[model samples]
Every structure is written in structure tokens, then in C-alpha cells.
Target: MNEYLPLATLLRLLAVLTLTLAPHVGHLPPWVSALIAGLIVWRGLTAYRQWRMPGTMVKIALALLAFVGVLVHFDGRLGGQNAGTTLLCVMTALKLLEFKGRRDVMVLIFLMYFMLLTHFLFSQEMWTVAYLFVCVLAVTAVLIECQHRGALSPRITLRKGGIMVLQALPLMVLLFVLFPRIPGPLWGLPEDSAAARSGLPDQMAPGDISRLIESDEVAFRVEFHGPVPPPSARYWRGPVFDHFDGRAWRDSVPTFASGLSSRLELLGEPVSYAIMLESQRGRWLFALDMPAARSLPDDAFIGREGQLLARKPVTERRRYELTSYMQYRLAPELDEHARKRYLRLPPDFNPRTRTLAATLRTHYTDDEALVTAVLRMFHEQPFVYTLRPPPLGRHSVDEFLFDTRRGFCEHYAGAFSFLMRAAGIPARVVTGYQGGQHNVFGDYYVVRQSDAHAWAEVWIENRGWVRVDPTAAVSPQRIEQSIEAALDAAEGLPGHLAARTRLRFYLEARWEWLNGRWNALVLSYGPELQQRFLERLGLDDLRDTILALTVLGTSILAFMGVLTLRQFAPEPVRDAALREWQRLTRRLARAGLPQRPGEGPRDYAARVAAVHPEWAQAIHHITQLYVRMRYLDDPDPAGQNALVDAVRAFKPRSARRRSWIRS
Candidate 1:
């Protein structure tokens, strides 16, 4: 294919586009973007003959340098987000030099698609999804352009491809909403799953939960199958840390082995609901503390310590059904070791505070009075709850109580648990987000990392561990307000700004409604949903979707075959071969041989020859004309009429049917 413009120039243009791709995107890291941009300039100069293409040896050496540079930039480990992104950037840059033909551009398009998938791996928020879809269309546009040489304009190709994608949208949605969902990652340990943790760690230093509070990213989403739980009833309890290291708390109990059925005894009214938690890389789940039962798909088991735990680390989105008793009795008998861990204090860490706790214990004879005095101190004292707490060095609880008494949930929880332990009351910390932006549009709570908070639970005589939040005594508005208001200022945060204005608030609300569907539907899929899908479609419990799709695919192929045959049917054969019939009948009638209407071609031909011998030749000529008109599809109306005239001119061997006229 000889070309007008140099294919070399077009190829170089594509190469430059590939090289500059990182810079074009905001999502790509800055250093990579800069390097890619520099490569584009260098390649453009080479294209202009400002410099010859680097010598073969030089190119090879430079490629090795780039490879080493990538390995270094990605911390030498070849996995996870940073490494994957670095590899993509390096390939994108190197592809510029190696550009040869259209196929190479096709490679770039494939890489672009992989890049889109990477974006989904990080965040599947609605805006990200919408942006990535546009990117998909763009890459698809490039794919279509590569298929044709010079005939198709890129603009026209893109438009056509977009139209086709739009046409395919209904089918995609039908599959998305109706198709079954499966729990866990599609493959295995998750492509980028080194991000796993042992659930939200049961311990936190001074800054842990507050740092969690800086994020607005989703932790989990819940949808109930039955009666909806009120907002106040929605305490998605997670980790219960009984072990306290001077500053933080930890998992005091042993790892649950199997079903501790002996430890569990069902009681009180149960509230059944489901929780779809995003991958936190942590093992502990946020339940309402006493989940009565769990989804069969989920490997949920209860601990003797009365906390619900997942069977595996959550590396992918998870959804599980849970039934909980908001008022269940747990650990009617608190063991001595459990009591010690719950009431343990770090020696000599906060001595003065310890002394103060001892004094409070001496002052208040009853445990109820002690709890009342602590809550009253928070209420009456100059203790203020604020997002930006002053940095505490050591003796953090002491600093929080005396000096910079203004701090968030962690401070309150840490101090409250510390004081309870000091008063000889067994208490431990509970960490989870409190309050969420209630979506007015969808009526679902969107608890973000910013909503992360801490509180204490005190084991009492008759009742189970009673929930208490010291922070609530300071700022009652914090729990009532969204976490953004609790945090007050959005400074130093990545993307956790509040929607303060009506317009922005409305826009944010609409965006969140869209995101909630994505979270509930796409990101948070599990095995139960997968089964329900197959069951709904009338498939046997034993069969799977892949087998079902196979059957459907085979049927489609068979139907397509019939349609294709109809599409290419011969039109010439369909005109009834009228000219041939007319010619044959006329000659037969001249021979005193009448032809019947709708008679077979072979039969008519035979009868005409059997007529009077004088007109036998004429009959033969008419039959030959019929064959040519019907088989060859000769569009010769005049020739056909001439043949008819010849038949009339010759004379008939027999009479024919009167219906011999041809339209």
C-alpha cells in the first residue's frame, strides 16, 4: 500500500502520543509523567532529523538504563500499584522508539486498556468509572482506526465506535444488574492485594484513628433484606481490643480456632442485616457486636470474647448477612486474665493520671458513681473535642487530660478506658467510624474514614459491656453532624472536603447516589449473589453461569446460520422465472400442446417435445430460452420478447394454456 504522507511520520506521531500519554493524564504520578513528557520531546527532535535515531547499541544500552530506572523507582520489588504503574510508564516510553507499523499502535491501544483497568483497581467511585469508560471508548476509537489503512478518518471511526458502544450499553447493563456476583477477587489473592492488613488493627497510637478520619473513602455499605435498621441502631461493630499497650489497645484473646459454640448462647430480639465492606486488608468486621447468625457464604464465627470475626482476610469487596441482638448478654462470667487485660495499665507511663484515677476510685464507692464522675469531668471541665489535636509526645493520656485537653475520639476513648482501668472497672477500646453523610437521594449512610471514632465499653454486673463515648460529652454535635463537621476543617486532607454550599451539596449528593450503586453492585459482590443469579434464571443448583453461557452461545450460533442463509438468497431465482414459463407455453400451444399453469419446468419441456414433429424444433428453442433467463439471470427483455415472436412466427405443434402472458 503506497501512501501519500509518510507512514513513518504517522507512526512517529503515534509514538509521540504514546510517550506523552502519562503527562496527558492527571492520575499518573508526577515523576513518571515528567519522564514521559521528556521522552516525547526527545523523540520529536529525532523525528525532525535534529538527531539521528540512537545507534542500535546505544538504544539497547538506553533501554537497559530505563529498565533499571523503573526497578529503582518502584523500590526494586516487582508487584503492587507502584511497580505496575512504573512498568506501564517504561513500556509507554520505550514503545515510542520501537514504533514500526499499525500493529505497534494496536499494542499501545491494548496497554491503554490495561491502564484503564488499573484505575478501577484503585477506586471505583462513580466519577472514576465514568472517566474510565470514556477512556475505554477513546482506546476503542484508536483500535478502529488501526483496522483501515487510509480510507477511514479517525474522527469518523471514533464516532462509529462510540455509537456501537452506546448500542451495547443496554446489553452490558443487563449483564451487570442481572448477572450473578461472586465474593472475593475474580482471580485469587487480588492482583494488587499486598495491601491486606489483619483487619483494622485492634490497637492505635494517638494518631491512628484520626489519620483514618482524614479519609472520605468508603469502609463498607449495608443494605437490609427486611426491616431497615434506624440510624441509631446501625452500630457496625468491628474489632474489640482487650489488650492495652500503655498508649493503645490490642487483641487480648487468642485467635479463634473453630466454632466456639460453647461460648455462644442466643438471646434477646435479633436484627438481621447485611454488611458489604470494602477491602480494608484487615480481618475484623464491623458488626453490631452480637451478630446472631451470618450469611452461609461468609465464613463467620463467634468468639468466646463475643466479637464476630471473618474466616479470611478481606482482600476484595465483601457482603455478608448478619443477625444481631442489640441487647444481648455477653461474657456473663469475666475471667481473671480477661479482667486483667481489660483493666491493665502501663506502669509509670502516666503516673500522675494513675494517681488521679486512684483518687477517683477512693472518692466514688460505687462503679456507677465513678462512671458518672468521669462523664461529668468531660462535661464540666474545660475539655473540648476538636479534630486538630495538639501533638502529644509521651504520657499521651496525661497530656490529653491536663494540657491540650482538646482532641478527637482516640483521646477520649484512650483516656476513658485508662480511667476505667484505674478505677478497677474492666473496660477496653472500640474503634469504628461514627456518623455519616446520609444520602438524601438514596437514604443510605455513607460512613467515610473521616467518620472513624473511638469509644469504650465497660463490663457491668447485670448488663453486658455498656457502650460509652467520652467525646460525646464534649461535643454532642459531632455525632449528630457528619464527620466532616466533626473534623471541622478539611485542611491537609487529600479529598475530604465538605459540601458546604447548596449547589455543591446537591451535586455531591447526586454523585454519591451514583457511587452507592457502584459500591453495592459492582465492587461489593459475594458468593450468595452469584448463587441467587443462577437460581433466578432457572438453572439447577449444580450448574454454573459459564456452562449456561456456553449453551446460550451455541444456540445463538445456530440461529445466526439461518439468518445468514436468508441474507444471501439468490434474488434471480425469486422472480418466478416468468419469462422462461411464458416462452415455453407459447411454443407448446403452437404445436397443439397446451401447457398447464404452475407446471414443473422438466415436465413442460418433456410434453412440448412429445407434440407434433413440425413444431418440435420451436419447442426446443423456447425451452433453451427459459433456461438462459432463469439460470443466467439475463436482463434482456427485448431478447425475451424476440424469442416470444420467434415462437409465434414458427407456428405451434399443439394448443397451450391461455394463461401464457408474462408480466
Candidate 2:
């Protein structure tokens, strides 16, 4: 089949394969991409130049080399998602070298489809969906071209394939609406499902969140039931860190005590909203500060430290509804053990910070007053709020507070928490996102990784856990507006979050709104949503749903099958000129001057004119008219009419009459 395969068709296949494999280039190893590219070029050259394919030994050597390369690149484990995808890509490229038969082409096409499916493992955004659709259409067109006995125009082939896909849309919709949806993703490897996501970490050090501030990736999106909380109150709580080990703060083992409800005091009007949280691959979930215990997601609870957590890591995008109180008191009465736990700090670290805390404590004996004094110091001093803070030494808090006043939210929060602990106050660092950008077009807020923040949560005698953002004291604009506004002009914001011109901002807003709609309407369709939709459609019973699905699905398929058959069914003769030409040929055949099988109108006319010289002029005239009207580009309308009229009026002479004329 390789010998007979058209260069055009081979090129088409290669083009589709390239499109299918392009998205993976970012994640696949550089060598793999380079190798695949080289092989594709080699295949194209081999087809075009008619070069011989690699020998069996050469093929074996290439395969073994690829195998070894993949094994070495993946640390000898070929079982995981990355390894398997790499192997598939390499094998697909290798398959190009041995394009022996139609079966091989079919195998390659199927592999392309599989590769296209793997794209969803990384992203299911609207652009990805549209790209995959185009790739599918291209692949389908190539598949159709492969089955043709003769060359067809690329446009015609593509149109036919597109028609087939459009005809199948009804069935696709039926299946999508009625098919039973599993709880999680339909296709994914558990081990690598959340590997590509970036968000808050469980631990917070001097620059942990400051580094996060550089990423534009979305952490989650929130659609509030009412007005969104003010910027100062929009602290999406994530992990709570009570254990500060010198340079970093880490979360203690979450205590799922039954008395969590008793410890949390809900106040003010409850803010009802739903969060479409992106996968962070962590057990902790983020909600507005002080999420109510009663309004928690299933298999999730508020930890003793007031951090919302789930039983399992968020391996996929999850939408959960919760009611949180912007104003709430937590753990009003702190026990001795808990107080000590929150106050504990690594010894012999940040001696200067400890000394400063002791000095501030003597000045202001009242805990609340002392807190205010530290905040005042931060506000009055020349502490700079910047993303590019200098590197911290072993005494990070000490250095940030004294030596270099430049630091991010984490730095300020860490120093404040350390000072509070040293001054005999129960204080801990609370890490989460602080501010969200509102997408007015979508009526939702987009919380990005850039919004990741840390603040001090001090346990006052009667106030319980109070939120204290020392960074706000240093740079109040960070809390009031966005990080973009808070940072100096010298500091750059994430690409997506950077300020834009009015037109560009509008365009970005529209695009984000479209993506939000896609996520809500398409990606959020899970088992529970499917059930609700079916119920609304009066498909309450499982049997009824299945029955309806089967019936509707079969009907759609049957309709599509009939349409397909009609499309492939032979077309009737419709051209008047061609019909007249056929009639003329039939008349000649009856006179025993039949047109030979492989004879064109001109050739048959020439043969007849030679046989009967008396009819030569007339035969030549008819042939000329027919050829011009039938074959030439945009023949004159008068010429077509003349051919039809001439064929109708002219009658051929019989063999006897021709012989008589000859004698």
C-alpha cells in the first residue's frame, strides 16, 4: 500500500498527526519532540523522493533505542501516564517509518485519535475543545480520503467528512445528555491527574507565597449569591499553620474534634456562594474566612484551627456551596495545650525578633494594645511591600523585620506571627488567597495564584482568633485593591493579571466570561448534575432513563445512517448537454456505428468521419459543439443550445446507406 499511497494522502495524514501531537510538545521531553519531528520529515521525504523504507534491522534498532530512551527518561518506569504517553507518541512516530499497508495507516489514524484524547488530561478549556474538534474533522477527512479508489479534491473530501460529523451531532448530543456519568473524570490516571495544577502549598516560608504571586493560574472561581465581600474581607482561607519551625510554618495534623461547632461562633449576615475550585491536589479546600461548620461539603469539615478540609485530595475541579460569616469569633476560650501549640516557636532562631517582641511587650502590657503597636510600627516604618524580597537567612523573620524591611505578604505575616508568639501571645500564620479579580462579564470573581496571601491569626482573650494582615499595615493598597495596584511600578505583575488598555481589557473579560460559561455548562456536568437534568426531563427512574437513551440514541443513529447512505448513493444524470450527448451516441449505436468503450466524443467522431467521408464535415461540427459545451470552461450558452438542438435534429446514416453512398 505504501507503493500505491498518494503523496497527497500521506501528507494529509502527516499534517493531521502533527496537529494532534502539537499540544503535547509542551509536556513531552524535548528529545521526544525533536525525534518525532525528524521522523515526520524523514517520512515525507521518503514518500516524495521514493526512497526505500528502513530495513528490518534498522527498524528494530530504532524501536529499541526509543524504548531505552523512554525508560531512561522516565526512570525505568513505563507504567504511569507520562511514560505511557511518551511511549505512544514515540511509537506513533515510529509507525510512520513502516507505512506498509492500509491497515498501518488505519492504525496510525487511531493512534492520532488516542493522542487527541490525551489532551483532555491536561486541559479542558474552550480553546482545547475547539482545537480537538478541528483535529477530529481533519482526521476524519484523511480517513475518508484513504478509502477512495481515485483522487478526490481535498475540499470535496473535507466537506463530505464535515457533513458526516454534522449528521452525527444529534447522536452525540443524545449520548452526552443521557449517558450515565461517573462521579469523577471519565478518563484519567489517578497518579498524574493533578500533576499540572499550581496553587497554595501546605507550608509557608519567607517567600513561598511571594513566589506564588508570580503565577497567573487561577486557583478558583467564586459566584456570590449576593454582593461580593469587600476587598479587605475577601480572605479565602486555606491551610492553617500553627507550627513555626524557624524559617517555615507548617500545618499541624488536623483535629476533627466533635466540638468544632461549639468553638465557632457565627456572626453577621451569612454570605452564601458557590466556589468552583480548581484542582490543587491537596486535602485542604478554601472558603471565605470563617466558614460555618453546618454548611460544609460532604466528606469535608472545618478543622479545629478553622481551616476547611476534605477527606481526599481535590484531584479534579470541584464545585461546592457554603455559607461563611465575614465576621465570626473562633475558639473564644483557648485551652492551655492549644495556646502552647499556637505559641510554640523554634528556639535560638531570630534572636533579634524575639528581643524586639520583648521590648514591645514591656511598652504595651495589653495584648490588643501590643498588637496595635506592632502594626503601628509596620505602618510608620519604611517596610516595603514587594514581590522581589531579598533572600532570608536562617533568621528569616529577624532579617525581614530589622535588616531588610522589603518582603511579601508571607514575610510580613511570618514576622508578625513570630513576634506575637515571642510576646506570650497565641498567634499562628494563616495562608490562603487574599483578593480576587471580578469578571464583570461573568458575574463572578476569579481568584488567581497571584492572590495567594498569608496573615497572622492571633488568639486574643475575648476576641478569639483575629485576622491581622501586617502586610496591609505596610501596604494597605494590597488589601484595598489588587496586588497589581499594591506593588511598585518597578515590580511586574503576572501576564494575565497585568493592567491592559480598555479595549484589551474588554476583550479579555469577554474571553474569560466565555470560558467561565464553558466550565459551568460543560465541565461541571457530573453525576449529580446529570441526575438533576434527567429528573427535570421526567426521567426519574433509572430504567426509564436508560430506555429513553437507548431509544433516542438508536433513532439518531438510524437517521444518520440513512442520510449517509443517501449521500453515497449514485447521483442521477442531470446535465442536459450530457443527456443529449448520450442520446446522440445511442442513435449512432442503433445505426451500427457504436462508440467504442474508451472512446471520447472526438475520437468516435473522427473514426466515423473517416469511415464515411461524406459525413465528415457534419460529424466534425457536432463533435466540436459537444466538446466545447461539455468540457471547456464556461462554454457559451448558445453553444450548449446548438449542441442540444443539433443532436435532436441530426440522424446518422445506416451502414447500407453509407455503402451505397460510397459506391
Candidate 3:
């Protein structure tokens, strides 16, 4: 067994296994990856040294330790996606320790294929898919090597495996195109599978938005049916926080007022657009401030605060069509409940901010005049729009407004909302994404986490809740251009933005465009898209889809059958001596005496000679030449030719039926 399975084959299998498990490292626990690496190193060393494999008891003990470690690490919750995947990965690595035979190798290869699929559960990005494909090819090559006899090179195995994969492409494409597309599970994934998203949070603390500002990960993508909205107008509203607890601004009871059909008195022509929202693991959806969608999914609805919310958390990419009026009035007739909530603030939170608001209130008579005064103060104040800001004391808003005066959008929005509430005007902090980069190639706006912005919305007597962004006052360029443009040249950008040359930036933008295409064309392919695709194929309904699938599947099978027949067709024996020897045996059977089954040439010849002694010399001589040519190696071509000639020329007469056959 050791002789058959070479060190090179083992190393190649280990290399492929490493690639299959590499992507999982980031998702699984750190110890899991480390343990896997350690096991691989140990296995490789053992194979290189030709050492005896681990015994059954040792392998069983190690497996138990791995199982216990996984359970303890995940706190005994071994059912969900991450936990199950971690356990599978740990066990798979341990399987390498007891690599006994071909059966064990086959099991590992099958498990590796399953592990590759789990990677898509975490991320379906184009780069990840491409990387997984490479891993698949490598694993397939190792599988081929397992079945193959003799010492073949890795390159040959890889070539054969690649050919096999290419041949399977036709069937894969047929299945992908014709397969019935169904929606995801109605109940959604397991609770633990729905990992927390990294974008906006429902609760906004002092440095929540600041921390998000560093991330370049996309929040969602929007494709405008008409003109793309200007950066100033693209305020995708998310969570509305009216309850302030001195340190963090939180959502009030009214914020959860979704599932209720509320009509908005839209004033202007609605901007029709489709938003491909990334799963944020929360119900809150981002849209224009005054959004009005004709038909929302059963799980989704527009909240009373004009915020979109889902009945359940979003665990997959959701593409919903919405018509939003950038210039529209929302909740003009404000109720007392909402009014009181917006104006409600902790009593002893920020004394100085309240005093300043009072002074401004005394100076400005009307609500509009007070709003203008507040805007003027924000514009005139030396408030720096920076990600890093000085830590605030208990009075966060007062410290930010009076002392620190340096913070991100959260600080400005919090301070402005406090000033509004202090001046007796109902206000709330609106947290959502601000500007988005418009991709020229794909014609979609990519809103990123760094674009996350917070602003205050004040409800006046007649105008309702007016959108106000104090960050714009401090850094207008942040809205007009981008976050990078707004940051000071001396302060520098984060890793994603910093050290990016023009060429690198261009390449990155192009890569984003490709990723956007993948998201739209591949990942977004669901029931509706499948139906549309079927319509093109004249398979509109379920009956038609099934029929078409049957026809195509049958056609594929028929074609495969023909290829299979061609692949395994019998070929004539190329050995001249063997072919001639087979002919000699047939001629002897034509006589009265025939060779019995499982009879060797030497035995058969002796039996034939006893029955017909007249051909004894020829039979004995032929058997000797045949055995030497067939069983033993003969380099002389003339020797094989002589054997063939002798067998064909020697025609033995039948012992008893020769005269009767002649008559």
C-alpha cells in the first residue's frame, strides 16, 4: 500500500486539501485553522519520513478531543451554520491523520467538495467563487490520482481532471438554466446563520458612526430609472432615533410602527429606482427620506417614520422596487405621541446646550428662524468632521458643542437634535447612508458603510419633518464629493483609501463594476428572474418548465450515452502473438475435442494431443512459443511474427469427423 501511494501523491492531496480549507479559516475559529495547519504539517512530515500511520485508538482519541473542543468553543450550540461548519472542518482535518486506504482518501475528497459549498454560504462574491473554482479543480485532480494506477505526474493528473470538468460544463449549464428556481426558505436560516451585518446599527453611540466611517464595504446598491439624484439629495434613510439616553441615541416605540399601511401625501414626481440591499441582519431598510413603493414584499413595509422595515431580519440579498420623492412632505400632520417622543430628552443630560438653545430661541422668534440660526452656528463653528474625536464627558452633546467641537456625523446630528429639542421644536436623529459613488459602467450607485451619515429631522407646524444635515454645514465637500475629498490632506485616509495610486484606484473601480455585475446577474437570480428567463424559452408555467427540463435532460443523457459508448468501445488486441494464440485455440475447438474453461495453453495442448496424437508435435511447439511470448517479455519482433505464422499455417485434422465433414 505504501509502495503504491507515493509521497508526491500524498503531498499533492494535502496541498489541495489546504486550498479547500483556506477560505474557511476566516469564517471559523482561529484555533480551528491553526489546528488544521498543525495536522497538515504533521501528516506531511509522517508521509515524508515513511513513518507508520496513527493507530485506530489514537485517531479516535484525537477526533473526540476535536469534537469536544468545537463544542466548548461554540458553547455547545452545534446546530447552526458556523458551528456545524466548524465541526465539519475540524473533523475533516482529523480524517487526514488516519489516512489508511483509497476509501479514506475518497471520503476526504467528497468532504472537501462539501466544504467548498459552505464557503458560498458565507459569501457569494465573484472573487470568492473564482477562488473556490480553483480549489475545486485541485481537489478533482487529487481524486483522479487516487484511482489512477502507476506513477503519473501531477501535471498529467491535473490535465485529465481539467478535461473532465470541462466535459461536465455542458450538463452544469443545462441544469443551471433549466432548473426550477424557488425562493429561499420562508422561515429563513437558523438563528446563528444570520450573522450580524457590518453597516449601520439600530442604536447609535458616540463613536458608532465614526467606527463605520473607516469601512469601505458596500451597504447597498441603487439603480435609478430616471436621473441619478445629486449627492446632496441621496440621503437613504435607515433608523430614526428619538430616544436619547445621554450617551447613545436609540429607537423609540413608534420606530417599530411597520406592517401598517400608511399613505404619504407625495408632492413631486416620484423618482423610480430599484435598491439591491445587502443583508444587514436587521429589518431596517434604506431608501430616500420620503419613500413610496407601490408593492413591497410581504415581509417588508414602510414604518410610520418613513423608514422601511422588514417583518424578519434580512439574511439574503433583497432587491425591491421603490418610488421615492426626494422633494415630498412626510407626516405633515404630526400626532401628539410622535411630537412628545421627538421632543423627549433626558432632563439633566446637557445643561449648557439647553441654555444656548434657549438664548437662540429668545433671539429667533419663529421655528424657521431658529433652524436658520442653528444652521448658521454649525457653519460658523470650528466643528471638525473627523472620524477620530476627543472623548466626551457625561454631557456628550454639551461637551461636543461647547468644548470638543470635533466629531463625526453622529456628534453633529446628536448636538443639532438636542439643540432643536431644547428650543421646544420636535426633532429626531436620522441615521442612514449619505452619498454613493455612481459606477459609470454598471450605471448604479454603490453606497458604502463609509458613506454612513446621521442628521437631524425637525418637524415644524405645517412643513412636517424637514431633513437637515449638520454634517453638510461642517464639511459640504463630504456630501458634494466623497469622504476622501472631505478629509484633510494632512490627516490622511484609512488603509482602503490611503496609498491608492491613480492606477490602483482605477483597477479597484473596474473590479467593483465586475462585482456589481455579478451581484445583479448571478446572485440576484431568484424566482422572478427565473420566470422571466423561462418566458424567453416558452416555458412560462410550471408544467412547461418541467416538460422543457425533461426534454433537455433526456437530450443531455442521450448525448452522454453516445459519448460513453465511444469512450469505452472495445479495441482489438495489439499483441500479434496473443491474437494468433487465441485463433489457434478456436481452431482446436472446431475439431472433435475442445478446451475446457479456465484451461491454460499448456494444459489444453496436452489434452488435445492425447485425443489427436497426429497433431501432438505442432500443438506442443505452439504452446511453448505462445507462453514465452505472452507471459514473458520478448523484445524480438521477428519472434512474435514467427509465432503468428506457425499458428495460422498449422491446421490439425479432426480425429473422427474429418472424413465425414469432407463427404
Candidate 4:
């Protein structure tokens, strides 16, 4: 009935709570983090100093203040995922101040569990899962400590908690495998669930993709069914930008043309592959160039411009299979409206570049020849392919083409597209990823943000849209090798993309392979996959599947229940000295001097000595030796043997004989 809590127990709870809240520190507001930290410290101090609990009015005021803070920080919106997580954290911190006894601690521990679940809302990566597992173990240990009748050592409590977790593992696996998964995610994802992801945007400008090149995050990973595509053929298509506004290139209104199949002509043999795409929070699904219509995923379709797109934004890691051809003709016959759309440019920008385009056009009467000339010029000129390019003026393409002459892929693609449009060639800039690093250990290609690229797609008379990469003309290494090889040694690259020692490379490759397996085998286990697995097990019918799940689930629960009950089962006597001591106690009980419950050896021995004064010396000696051997820090083996010998030698008469002697 006591409302008091031990300091050690309180501190253990705080430690676990801190562990649960650590991952949110990166995304939670700084003020919220500080408030939580302050509250935690104050709670610890209150427990240590035995301070009174916060008054009800004070708790109410604190709650209101936290609500206001969340509202103000989130710009008056509290319904979104971020706002909700922040509020949950705030409420948890507030709860810490009033933590008094068993009820409050239970509430706090449950809150910790809920907060731990919130992390998966942001990221469900392999590392995130591992971290959450550790947090769960720690929190479980603290919970066990709370229920214990007496204080338990941290090691003992953790061991017991781990045993419980191990016992439940079978049930967990059964539920995960047999639970009838619905289509898509288990729950509706909040709007902001995919916030803070990085990849190619819906638009591209001079520095947009170049900046993306600095990030080493994987855009997607591909496992080719047959031979892997060559480096030059590894252009994963994303958003196509046809509308140029001088400074930026934006995607035109998408027309999911009914005649798309008629327009696209596949030339070369198709390359089939499966892509495990990371969340980019955009509708554009990157696939190899010119994805075939037949092999497209059920939820995705090829856009009017030949780029693959999802029906909805990819808010989680997704796996999809597709067939694409390196050689293909998209929109073989361009209509007037589409032609005008691709060629339209701002009237007053890049005058010098336009003039140069005109002069090149004049020299080469044929459009293909003009395109060849531009690429040749890029190859012959002093244009440097570098990550750190000089800033451009208002006429960005003009500056890059005439003055600076050094830029990343986006700059080259933008200038090339502008010149093609200027010279009266229908052209547009296509932004996506170019080269990917093959994770040899996993036998998959990892396309990263650093591989993000922009190239010009110009329409020709018979070829339809021809892919022209001006950057490749300047530096072939970028296409043939990697971004690291493309740039000079002095130009900085992301740490993961940079060169590493052989040992480090090996470790990283193994880790990446593990991650790939986790993603493919675990995170990508959706409803369809579950159904396939169940069908393999001959549980095709819904009723059969549910019945199997129930039977297996009940069996696991019953097994775990038996294991748990065994832990509480009384232990059998094992030690020789203890067995002899028990025999002595039995003899005393027969003589009507039974050892009571919770009686210690010394106390029992003293009471028996009082009952039989003649045997006091022998009883005291036995009890002293037993107590020393059983309870002392370092009792000798000799002492244990001595206690056993002395208890065995001690003899007592029955109660009737003792009473006769006393009479």
C-alpha cells in the first residue's frame, strides 16, 4: 500500500526511458528535447531528495504549456505525425514528474513502449530494428524489477527478462508468419511519415543534382535476374523535366496517354530486374531507361515521357520488378502539342548560348549532325567535370557554356538541353541516377544519391528521343566508373562514397549485404508475399490459414506458460549440508520443536537449545557452522563438511520421551 518508490528503481526506469527517447532527438524540436531532459533530471532529484510530488494544478499548467509549445512549434497544427510524436514525448516527460508508485510506473513503462514504436513511423531500417530491440530488452528488465517483491540485482533482473523474451520468441515468429496481412501497410501512414527523405526532386536546376551528388544515401538497390547491366547502360530513369523556366526545369503536366504502348518501341533484348527502392516520398519510381509496359508493377505505369511513375508517392521501402531495354524509341512520332511543350524555353535568357546554338545549327544542316557537333565540342573543349563548379549568373546556361566551362552533370544537361531547344530541336532534361556501385557480396547494384545525374533527351527525325549526356563527353570516367573516379582527388566526396582500406571495404560490403537481405526478406514481406508463403504451405483458404494461426498461436502460448510456471516452481534440495540440516529440522519437528516459516538457522537453533538444555552445546555448534558456511562471503569447504558431520551426529528423542524425561 506504500506509495514510495526506491531510488534505484526510479533511476533504472529513467535510464530505459532515456534509451527509448534517444532516437527521436534528431527529429524532435530542440526545446522539447531540453524540456524532457530537464524533467528527467528533476524527477531523479526529487526521488533522491524525497521531494513532494508536483501538485495537481502545477501538473495541469505544465501540460497546457507543453501543448502550447507543440502548437507554436508546429505552426498551429497538432494533427500531423511529427506534432503527435512531439506531444507524446512532452506528455511522457510531464508524466515523469508525478511518478509515485506501481500504477504511475506501469503507465510510464507503457508510454516508453509506445514511444519506441513511434520510431518505426520514421525509419524501419535494419539498424533501427536492432536499436529498438535493445531498448525493448532494457525496458522489460525495468518492468520486471518493478514487480519484484524485493530488490533484485540488475544482472539478475536482466537475465530473467531476457529469458522471458526468449520464451516469447516462438509466439512472435508465429504471429509474424501466420497473421493475415492486408494489402499495403498494416496501418494508414500519416501524411508526414515520409518527411526528411532525400532523392531527386520533381524539378532540376544547375546545382540541384550536383548538391544531391554530395549525399551517399542509397536511392535504390537492384538485383538483376540475369546479367547485370553495363555501367553505361545503368541509367535509372526518374522524373523527366520538359518545362524550362530559365533557372529551373519542372515536369510538365503528366498525361497518362492511352496510346503510350503504341508510341514506345523496344529495340534491344529486355533486361529484367527487381528493384528495392528507398522512400523518396515522390510518385516517380526510378527504373532502367524505357521500362516495358508489360513488366511494369501493378501500382506503377510509364509516364507519357517514358519515365516510370507510381500511382502514389512511395512512403516506405518498396520492392518492384520491371523489364527495361537499353535501346528504345520513346514517342517515335511526336505530336505538335508535345513537340512545342518539349522545345519551349524562356524568351530572354541564355542569349549567348542561343546564339552559339544557332551558329552550330547553321554549320550542320542535319539535326543529328548538330547534336554530334555539340558532344564533340564538349569533348574537345577545356570543360572540366567537377563537383565544385563556379557560380552562374542570371543566364546560368550561358555562363556555364561561355565563361565558367566547369560544372557537374546537371549544369551540362541543362546547357545541352537549352542549346538543343534553341537550335530548333525538341529537347528536354531527364534527371535520375546514372552509375551504381555493385555490392559484390550481395550480388546487387546500389544506386546512391551521389549517382544522381541529369542528361539531355533530344528528339530526332527517326530516332525519337535520343539520350545525350554532355558530362560523359567531358569525363567518360563518371559513366564508366563512379562519381569518386569522375571527380579529381582533391574534390570532396561523401565518406561512404570515398575510397577506403581493404578491411573497411570488406566490412562495409558484408554489412550492406546483410542489410539487403533484411530488406528483401523482412521489410518487403507484404500481403502478397504472405499469401504466397501461405499457399506454399498449403494454407490457401482463408479459414484454413486462420485456423492454423490460432492453433499454432495457442500452442506457443501454452508452451511459454508452462516454461514460466517452471521458473516459479520450488527448487529441490541439492547441497549435502542443507540436506543434513533439513534432517535435523525434521527430527526437531518430531520432538514438537518445529522450525516455523521464515525462521533462520540460528534462531531455530536457539529456540531448540532452550527446549533441550542438555543438547544446547551441540545445537549451537551445528547452527553456527551452518550459518557461516551458507551465509558468509567466503566460507571454506572444510566448514561445510564440518556442518554436515555435526548435523548428522546430533540426535533428539521424540516429544513423548522428552516429556517423560522432564516429568
Per-residue lDDT tens digits for candidate 2, residues 1-663, read 245568888887888899999998987999999999999999988889989988999999999999999999988888767888889899999998789688888899888888898888788899998999998899899889988756668899899889877877788888888888876666556465544368787688877897787787778889999877899999998888889888788867654433577888889999999998887767778999878877898779887777788876777677899999999888899888888888898889999988998998889999999999999999999899888888988888888889999988988998899999999999998888888888988889999888899998898998899999998998889999988788756477666567667898888779888887887778877777788889999999789999999899888888777876897888877886787788888888887789899998889998988876767777788888877777875767788788877876676756447687979
Regions of candidate 2 where Cα sits further than 4 Å from its true position: 188-191, 194-196, 255-259, 568-663
Give candidate 1's root-mean-square deviation (CA, Å). Answer: 7.8
Residue-level lDDT tens digits of model 3 in 457-476:
99888887898888889889
Taking the tens digit of each residue's C-alpha lDDT, what string does model 1 give over 338-398?
6777777778888778888899989997887898899999999998666678998678888
Query: Candidate 2 lDDT (Cα, whole model)?
Result: 0.84
Ten residues in sequence with the least summed lDDT for candidate 2: 187-196
Shift of residue 265 alpha carbon in model 4, Å:
1.6
> Candidate 4 on 1-663: residue-level lDDT in tens?
234556787788888888999989988999999999999999888878777888899999999999999999999988767898899999998998778768888999999988998998788888999899888889999999999756679998889888877777888888888888766555565556654378787788777888887786778899899987789889988878889888999877854433477888898888999999887768888888878889988888877777788787776678889988888887778889888988899989989998998899889989999999999999998999888888887999988988999998988998899999999999998888897888988889888888899998999988898999998899998999887787756476766666667888788879888988997788878777788899999999889989999998888888878877888998989866677789889988887789999998988988988878878999999888777766664666788778778877777874347778879
* Candidate 4 residue spans exceeding 4 A from truth: 1-3, 255-258, 567-663
Listing every candidate in turn, what is its Cα RMSD in Å to the true structure after a full C-alpha superposition?
7.8, 8.7, 7.6, 7.9
Estimate candidate 2's RMSD in Å: 8.7
**Which of 2 and 3 is ahead in lDDT?**
2
* Residue 90 displacement in candidate 2 (angstroms): 1.2
| lDDT of each candidate versus the true structure | 0.66, 0.84, 0.82, 0.84
**Of the candidates numbered 1 and 3, which has the greater TM-score value?**
3
lDDT of 3: 0.82
